[model samples]
Target: MNGYGSRGSTPGQGRGFRPRGGVGRRPYPQDAQEAQAARPRKLSCPPELRDAFVEARDFLAGLIAALGLPARLGFGGVDPARDGRQITIEVRSLADAPDRPDERGPDGRQEPGDLAILIGKHGATLDALSALTNAFMHRNNSRDLFFSVDVEGYRARRVATLRSIAQRCATRVLREGIALELEPMPPSERRIIHLSLAANADLQTESIGVGSQRRIVIMPRDSAPPVEPLEDFE
Candidate 1:
């Protein structure tokens, strides 16, 4: 006859609508479960946000030490809380220049070639450094954080280089009737080409292949685009 009595039985209660005490029982409705199920999962940042670029800087740190390079260096993380989701963690090293050196560039730039060993061999070494840093950050972060790592501003410079290449490729596609295929590049690099040529009406861009083989292709515009052709390209 307690609270459960009189009418029909309530959920998890006897016909009298009575409450029960047990090892794993709750009196309230399963509100938490219902709320959790109703909520949607969201990513903190887009795949290309600065927070996610970790593949470059970490490798440089290890490579410099192993190859016996200059030791003056500085590394840190930057979480500006950009927007609600994105966070940028910048790790840098100045092998030639002391981090807090009294003498600084007239323009306030870090000393040059401080981490030359890190940017070795046509950026092969630099690329490795970026990859290693990303791997490390991913392991240490509480949640799956995405960030880009730069060694001596390599990523920034690379972005400019990629944009130039994208423009040239787009031009070639417009001039020639054939499609232009670029060398394989990272996903971020491919995105750069896509964005750079997004406004091109005469030519369109698309990415193809998987993993290491993935690359961007620029093709002439067509009325009915081909299955994998970019935008209006056929």
Candidate 2:
């Protein structure tokens, strides 16, 4: 006999075996269907802002191409902050293009040392790019629009690291009953440090020093008993 014994006969058991019901199809759960139907959809952006973001993305794309960089621009999003007075356009580098001196490697992996060239010491290059892009927008009469260019999510990761450092230093200050001074950071980074410690009542934050030398000082609050004044007697 062949693999099939006869018409409508089970493959292995000959005439005695019968096929089970619903063998080819699994039933979908009603609750899961309901849940899927109830799930919320993503909200769409306002038309004017979306158009402006598209224009900004195209502008950056052309600029990157002109610079001969082996990278492509990806739109992150447009975020409005400072009570909607300021708009920030976030752009990411795709970096799928061929290896460049500071981009990729022959093995198709990112080179740390090369990437440091673009990021610069303490993200100076990245900040410069952001400022330059914002200036471009201003020159185009975009007005109040800013741009932040990040390669491979570097800025996001750095912000997280800064916040963690702030928390750890705050904890140490609370325990040691002494103040700690952090290394000099940019105004934006210093703001991150200050905001990270803002909610802790046992510690306080202060930024001091000249422009480039500015840093954050995490200090312990003095909660000790007050000394009584030695009055009278003369």
Candidate 3:
């Protein structure tokens, strides 16, 4: 008599075998509910700020219309820094019409294009428009406010990309025991990188260089030398 059956048998393949619980199974209903509840609420402007927000939004809308761009503007809300001194207003563009004939360039020559002309090379035109808007707001109001203009969510997506790069650089710094330098970026983008790694205790971040050459450097926390203790003459 053969000791083993013709079919090869695994320990768990017997007729009474029972699979382990929670293996290859979806999360429990309570777990899913808790995760949904943990999500953060959307940012909203304070009651006091609503009037100012509306004013700014209307001003921008009028400006856009005056430029002859067929786009609608919407306010995303104010993001106030923890220090309360800085606030950024998000402006989203809703392009609803076909491209119009290009408007005259600064030199009186007809430039061929549509509202996209506003989003110049790397958004230079948009930046210029934002600067003008900010100046207008300051001149008309008692409060000195800073403004950032975002066209079609460009800034939001850029921020997300910067955060991903920051994370990758941080991981490299922690694993390789060496410092890594990121390409020079504008102040707003640099802030994103700094915030992304702010919670990582194992990594230290610093911005070096000046002006456009400035960039972020990530190094291991232990890379810095210990401070020497001062001697007491007495």
For all predictions, the C-alpha RMSD in Å is 26.5, 23.4, 22.8
lDDT of 2 by residue, 96-178 (tens): 33334345433333434223444654567778867777777778574765667665445554565566567666766677666
Q: Whose TM-score is greatest here?
A: 2
What tens digits encode model 3's per-residue C-alpha lDDT throughout 96-120?
A: 2123223322322222335555655
Q: Is candidate 1 or candidate 3 better by TM-score?
A: 3
Model 1 spans > 4 angstroms off:
1-63, 75-117, 120-131, 134-141, 144-147, 223-234
In lDDT terms, how accurate is model 1?
A: 0.45
Rank order (by TM-score, best first): 2, 3, 1
Report lDDT (Cα) of residue 66, candidate 3.
77
Q: lDDT for every model?
A: 0.45, 0.50, 0.50
* Model 1 per-residue lDDT tens digits across residues 1-234: 000101000011101111123234223232233223212122233345433333333344455567655442232233455433323322333322333555433333344544544554324554565566556666866444434333444444455555655665566566656676666667767787898988878877778899877877778877333332222110
